[model samples]
Target: MREKLLGLVALDRLPHACVLESGTAEERMALAKDLAKALVCKSGVDRPCNTCDACRKADSGNHPDILYVGPENGRKTISVETVRNMRDNAYVLPNEADRKVYIIDPADTMQDYAQNALLKILEEPPTYATFLLLCTTKASLLPTVLSRTAVYSLSPVVGADQSDGQLEEAKGLAAELAKALASGSETSLLAATSAFEKKYELLPLVLEQLGLILRDALVAGSGGEQMISGAGKSAGSLSARYSNAQLLTMVEAVEDITTALALHANKNLTLSRLVSRLAAGM
Candidate 1:
């Protein structure tokens, strides 16, 4: 993902709008800053040359051309007025760099109206401006908002212990689930998910791994590199078999089930709902 972003920077092919999805808020913000720095870096081609003035300012979090937008004054949600203000400022020229970059952290917190306001600028962004929307999951953002931006999913770092026997079992189950999903067979899907009915403790890990597979599928479908080594074949088949919307729906389903499990919801019911959702979507 770093290489892909850098290549885009070197080629001056950064998208006007982008969505950075990750499970960790810090990871999303970190990458957003790196991309912003690369975009505003003074060195042409060899961007984010840490020695450049832009890179230095970005490192210090004082770059004028790079702006961070979010809920203001302890507010939980970003308001339409705030987004409108951002739109107004987006028209202004950059303070220093050749391009102006706006980083909207926790973009998923925006309400529908606020997102609509953001959509206006996304639809007709300034040629010299770039927008980076950071969120924990793409499902939080509206489909219309997602359609206008290039989406990048970042993998979270797993502990060494997670790479043990349990992880392997989770990966196997996740692969089966992915292939079953792509096969469009309800019985296959149920049989695949049945493994989770008894092993509730492993369901989270299985769902997490499944999310990665779907993420890889989305990336592969968009012509980016796949992240999961063991799931590459499954990801490739999923990419070829499902539309982006379908894959995204499955991703959202995984997220939903994960959240439900985290809340101590009924395990069997949650797993059943997931299967039903996937089957209905298909």
Candidate 2:
């Protein structure tokens, strides 16, 4: 994920707005700061070249063009007024560098009104401005907010020792399901999904892992090299087998089932619906 992100920076292809998610607070903040530094760095392509004045200023948190916005006055939530203020500041020309970077930490804490305020600017950000929204989960933000920005997960795939038996089993099931989806065989897909028929307890983990696989597929299909899901071979096959649109549909289907299961919906019925959705996507 780091390589892919830096590659985008080097290629000057990073999106104007992005959501960086799924890591510890410190990890996410560090990454956001590094990316901000890179954006404002004077070195072309080789950004954040530590020796540059911009990089030095960024490292010291003294860069005028790199701003950090979050809850103020010990408040737990960011208010709409605060977001509007940031939006207004975003329109101003950069003070030092060619670009302005705003790192919005704890973006998940923003209420609906605050997010809508942010969304207004996100919809039409200044050409010189870039916004990085940091959160533990992208689901905490509104769908409209998600649609307007690129999303990247900072969570590394769990290692074998870090995973319990159930998680390991879920990973296997997820890999099988990914391959099944790529195969476009309803029987194969059903067989892969059958593992979750009565195992309500493992359904969430399985769906989560499966979602990661789909994320990998999207990255792979877009010509990205790194696979954060650790299912590189399956992701490759999926990328080769499906178009971006189909993969997005599959992703939404997984998300819907995961959300339903979270709300204490009937596991069997949700699982059935998930299978139908996947098959339809194919």
TM-scores, all candidates, are 0.57, 0.59
Candidate 1 lDDT score relative to the true structure: 0.83
Report RMSD (Å) for each prediction in the order shown. Answer: 9.6, 7.2
True-vs-predicted CA distance for residue 99, candidate 1, Å: 0.3
- Candidate 2's TM-score reads 0.59
How well is each residue in 29-105 modelled by candidate 1, as lDDT tens digits? 88889899989998743567788999999999999999999999899998888999999999999989999999998
lDDT of 2 by residue, 1-282 (tens): 554565456446578999999979998898888889888888753556778999999999999999989999989998888899999999999998989999998999999999999988899989999999999999999999998998988875566575577778888888999989989999999998888766667877888787777777777787766455778888888889999789878877887897788689976788789899988779
Best by TM-score: 2
Candidate 2 regions with alpha-carbon error over 4 angstroms:
1-25, 31-66, 70-84, 90-163
Q: Which residue pairs in candidate 2 collide? A: none
In order, candidate lDDTs are: 0.83, 0.84
lDDT of 1 at 178: 91
For every model in order, what is the number of clashing pairs?
0, 0
- Output the worst ten-in-a-row residue range by lDDT, candidate 2: 2-11
Looking at candidate 2, what is the lDDT of residue 145?
Answer: 99
